[model samples]
Target chain A: MTGDTHYDLEILAELAEGLLDDATARRVREHLAVCDPCGESLADLAAVREMLAAVPVPAMPLGVAMRIDRALADEPNPFASVPVGANGLSKLSLVPALDASAEVDSEELATVTPIRRGRRVWVATLGMAAAAAGVFGASVLASSLMSAPGGTLAEPPATSVSTPERSPQRTLAYTVRASGHNYTSRELSGPLVGYFGPEPGTGSNNDEQLDACVQDKANELDRPPIAVDRAQYNGSEATVMAFWEDQSLDKVRVVVVDDNCRELRQDGLATWN
Target chain B: MTPPPEQPATPEHSAVAGARASVTDADLLARHIGGDPQAFSEIVKRHRDRMWAVALRTLGDPDEAADAVQDAFMSAYRKADSFRGDAAVTTWLHRIVVNACLDRMRRKSVRPVADDELIEAAERDTQLPDQTAEREVSMEVTAALKLLPSDQRAALVLVDMMGYSVEDAASVLGVPAGTVKSRCARGRAKLAPILSHLRNRTDLTRVSSAKGAELRDG
Candidate 1:
């Protein structure tokens, strides 16, 4: 029984996270239906989450941004040397070199531009010094390699320290699966209502048909439909809670299907308030 | 010269264009690549305050939130070229800010503070004039938010607090929309109970509905 209690927590966390497959989520839901302790734990954790959300964020300090601007001023563009991936970290290559001592002078811009455009500006004049440094550094590295008696000349150049070329950014796709002992709450009716984009007015509201589609998807995954408990029907939104086979935050997708059913929302866990 | 016949624009046409013009995070990013550092600044200005609020709410420390917001904007700028315009700018920015806060949390190894402790502290901090009551209400609600785990807190902040749709929030968090829906529901359910309790407390009750109207009118 003790072990089973622990097992229930494991199931609840997975269910809450929406990471479980359809069949697994279903089994957990069935268990939750019969298990009072597990159900209570889930609710308690959920309440805790809600309370934590009310915390306030303070106003941003003026100094941090000034520092960032200063850092950018002296930081040579990382793109000048390294490449980046669409989905990987880029632009940040120059960030590590951001020393607090770097001055944010307008003069640095005038000096730095000449090197890229090959103008005979003071900054370009300093390029000779940098080029010399590069040559000297390369020679030192080459000498160290050559001094190794068994070093292979045919070895490929070390590109490990260099950044890669830029590529298009990749969009992540997420899947949602829900299952639980069916409870009736008004908040759980209709299609899954989800928000999309930066602006609030741009998101979509699901009609009853969309709810049917969501239920159909759930059934297709072998999980029972989310049953409605009560509905406080407002003009556009109906607030209700439902008995899901499992209750996880991550097991839903909210999209604005165009007339052609083209999805317009980023794929991920949809929030409903 | 006669004006061209004024085309009657249908709502559908307007909707499509509106959606298109709403600029994705990737679009802003592409503009940054064209040597307009200001484009990056635009993105920063657009989401910086919201990102800061997210950090402050999750961490409950203004100084930590400041560092988090700066780091998030810098991270987004560095990774601007990687953006593909797949999600809204706000959502992507939220993800960056949340991730930065989480990273800070990991480094500091912090946990959520007790509810009563935070409530007591929040009560002490509620000192604004009655005329500015709405702002105080918002601040009060914000205090309870500090008790949630970072992930759920981020979800609730985007949904209930900021009023983002579940789908848009999912896009911002880079998760399935269904997951956002569940979290929003769970978050609201949890918040409703505590808020109901706070609604009865004397300090919070001081800001009446009439005061709320007065603040709005002012």
Candidate 2:
């Protein structure tokens, strides 16, 4: 067997798929006639392709069609609706519907409100402390701001709080906790509460008001969040909520704040931790 | 604007006639753009099944696939004016759906759930009793496909399963033809071992032994 002249797998795969040019295919065919191993390999690849092609095409689900109809009905001419500025560029405000499409239901949003209100207070307090502490506090404040909504926070929230737990040298003065796990930081409180229900210490009246607001917002939007939880972002903790449709996690919303509840950052569709 | 009042023919008859007519997809798109609302609906009715199939195989999660298809069609509706007419409407739609699936896959990778959860979800979707064996094999293939990198899996799905030509698959993938070819080859090479058990040919042992020897030598 002329095993010395074995073609690359890519070439053989292309030959099997009839993707190669005529000359190259002819050459591969000639080689395959003498090369038993190569021939078998080609046959195996061909079988794999056959099996893949045979994978059944499922019928379109009824829900998808209905959703599409509803969406189209709501926006008959999406292109025409795009507002144009003086420069002729489209001035598209962030559509709430687009955001709603990512979430599960109104209950998640309801859970997120109290947590957000609490975080805002803490962030405001932290912002003042950071301001008084000068550059170091400024850096923390900047990080805090970045973690807020509409701020350009790309990295996961876990990075800020997770490091102290993983690395011994970076001991934090304050305690940082999430999903029941605790880590200590010397600079601030370790407890980062991402509450789904009423905020602790808040009265039932306040809870009722928050729930009303959530319901109103939900009524306005077609889609709402599936679940909401508290998560720590950067050094600040926020109410982290997720919108899931069907079984997939569609979007995450983070309401980040500093320890003083002064520095507020609210973001929708943030990456899930 | 409303469509003109129809004659006393049945709806099914009209739909069948519509299907038989030589109205191109582009024609339907143009009609929709020109305010014929039913044109886009017709397009959706014709292609929704195939689009679902592509999304399902690519995503391996029925719920996610449905969401992806919804997103794709909505995007298509909104961006219909952006259609350049260089490719068939089906190809353009497939590209959008594939992209949506990839985006979901990327997000899922960033925050992966448990394997048990995934298997359970797949089982819930394929709960029919008559096709249990077929469903099992499909699930196995899907699980194996998930093990491959996203790009390789996309390439394999487009070319191998969906039967797109190499050039067309490359176009949809926005990669060079050579890259698509390599991705397919590498993807198949990985899948061969995983799927070998499904092959019942008499020459299986011989082929595997030859593959082993080749691996040892090379």
Candidate 3:
């Protein structure tokens, strides 16, 4: 060992960690036998490592396991019984309607079925509807009184629906449901084809008649509807649309009305609650 | 038809259970891919605690660690069919958990721990009259760990804290063995001053001396 020479701190540190090649480690050890400073540095590094090794392995938090279970339960098992389409949308049979006398609220039951379907695509339906409904209580069923005077689709605001102050419990329940069912951006378009008729036009209808129908619906509902369109609900011709009452994406108003400008029943449409 | 009466456990059932208990991780993963519903859950139950330990030490926050571990297992479950079997299942899990933790840290921009908060954490642990000396030391080590760069901390956590070999740590980090070694060296250098107090404690010093001797002889 050279009496005047000391190894670099990195080399000594590596030696301390036992990370050097056997030959390099031997050289460093021989130097350490004669060099107090290098030996002391190695000793200090070893102590640091030992102290770190002593840190407790904390028990996994209880909530983490519960959250994982919920997440896993919600996850669509690729190998499970559910059939998935080529586009990744699961083909779920329409959930059987719940008994009328069951304790489950219709809206709550409405929220539960799609979730059970385990289809990432369908989750967006409730999420979008819950977002549009905002603080409004039970969806107001609006149906178009009739087609425009000439049997053409009516203008925007076709029928009026009112926003009732919904209980906080309902809002929280819906919010919790929505948060659990996340949809991919691609799945957002799937709901459009299913709820609205093929190719629903964008940005508040350019057709004056459609605009008038939307205006009529907004005035009646007392909430402005966005993306108003002449659409179909379950093979029945209807006007389908959504509106936002607040800046939050969660606060949105959605309305579906029959061709005659009357409210549609909640059960008739798959996307609305 | 009435349901058949329940049968008591038989030698055949016990033999089946014994055989199943010896199934390898890869076999379990294969079973999951082949549509066995219980296999993946068994895998999760087996390795979750160790995965949690690696994540918690790497992230230094229980909430974030929990989130990372949960994400890792979910990803593992989803992509079980993709396992090429090139590495051990634990190694693959380590990679996933580490990546998840790093992704989370990157998303948050990993704000530096404020000096006051570090002081507060240290004071809080030390102030408890009933706190054991070992617990105090553990807390101190954890606090010191938070001071290192995330990558170095991860390497040190995997190798030093979790008792993984440097080569295994390299595989998990997706870095070379040399890189792992360098990171460990640098991390230990940085932690030395912070953990200096433990150097004087007889219990730790003796343990450290033995460990040092082992490393030197190796």
The candidate that achieves the highest lDDT relative to the unseen native structure:
3
Q: In candidate 3, what are the lDDT values of residues A150-220, reduced to their tens digit?
A: 23443322222232333222111111010111112222222222222111001113344555566665555
Cα lDDT tens digits for candidate 1, B80-171: 66655655566667778878887887798765566575545444322222444444455556665555556666787666555566677777
Error at A120, model 3, angstroms? 24
Q: Candidate 3, which segments miss by more than 4 Å at Cα?
A: A1-8, A17-27, A84-273, B1-20, B114-131, B208-211, B214-218
Positional deviation of A228 in candidate 1, in angstroms? 58
- Candidate 2 residue lDDT tens string, B3-109: 11321111122223245357777997887777665567667766775677678778877767877887898899878888888887877888899999999998878
lDDT of 2 by residue, A151-249 (tens): 344232232332233232332221111221011121012122222211111111223332333333333332333233233333234333333222233
The segments of candidate 1 whose C-alpha lies over 4 angstroms from its true place after superposition are A1-61, A80-273, B1-28, B111-143, B201-218
Better of 1 and 3 by lDDT: 3
What tier of docking accuracy does candidate 2 attain?
incorrect
Q: Give Cα-based local distance difference scores for all models.
A: 0.42, 0.51, 0.55
User: What CAPRI class is candidate 3?
Assistant: incorrect
On the 0 to 100 scale, the lDDT of residue B103 in model 2 is 97
Q: What is every candidate's C-alpha DockQ against the true complex, given to 2 decimals?
A: 0.05, 0.14, 0.20
- Candidate 2, superposed: residue stretches over 4 Å from native: A1-39, A79-273, B1-22, B110-132, B201-218
Q: Ten-residue segment with the worst summed lDDT in candidate 2 chain A?
A: A181-190
DockQ score, prediction 3: 0.20
Query: How should the candidates be ordered by DockQ, best one leading?
Result: 3, 2, 1
Model 1 chain A: which ten-residue window has the lowest total lDDT? A194-203
